[model samples]
Target: MSGVDAFPGKGKVAHCDKEKFDLKKELARVTRERDILKKALGYFAKQKE
Candidate 1:
């Protein structure tokens, strides 16, 4: 039997070869922004004490 047919669930696999890299970059940028915002909020709260 051929390689494709050897794998039973191959037909169900979804391909996103083009957008995969962009998605990872976007996720990293969002995470960094969130961390920076949290630190700023903490600094402001401490100043009010």
Candidate 2:
């Protein structure tokens, strides 16, 4: 009924799903790096005190 359905066997939707997955993976990686940096900063701050 919509524009995507009219295209039949086209793979456009799959491409969108892959893009979404990539974004989620990138977000997770950034969060992990941020947590690691935070812990390192805390350790250094304690050493300075």
Candidate 3:
């Protein structure tokens, strides 16, 4: 009925799903790195004080 259905049997859906998963993984890694940097900054600030 829709454009997606028109291309049935193609791996378009699978590709999108994979892309979404990759983006989520990247976001999680970046978030973890940010948290670590924040903690390091806090520690240095305390040392300076």
Please report, in order, the local distance difference test score of every candidate based on alpha carbons.
0.84, 0.92, 0.91
* lDDT (tens digit, per residue) of candidate 1 on 1-49: 9987787763654467437867898999999999999999999999999
Clashes of 1: 0
Q: Which stretches of candidate 2 lie over 4 Å from their true place?
A: 1-13
Q: Which whole-number lDDT from 0 to 100 does residue 5 have in model 3?
A: 88
**Candidate 3 ranges beyond 4 A from true positions:** 1-13
Best by TM-score: 3
Estimate the TM-score for candidate 3: 0.72
Error of 2 at 11 (Å): 9.4
lDDT (Cα, tens digit) per residue for candidate 2, span 9-49: 65556888889999999999999999999999999999999
Q: Model 3 — which ten-residue stretch has the worst lDDT?
A: 6-15
Residue 20's lDDT in candidate 3: 96
For model 1, the stretches where C-alpha displacement exceeds 4 angstroms are 1-15
Which one wins by TM-score: 2 or 3? 3
Clashing pairs in 3: none
| Worst ten in a row by lDDT for model 2 | 4-13
Question: Candidate 1's C-alpha lDDT?
Answer: 0.84
Residue 39's lDDT within candidate 1 is: 100
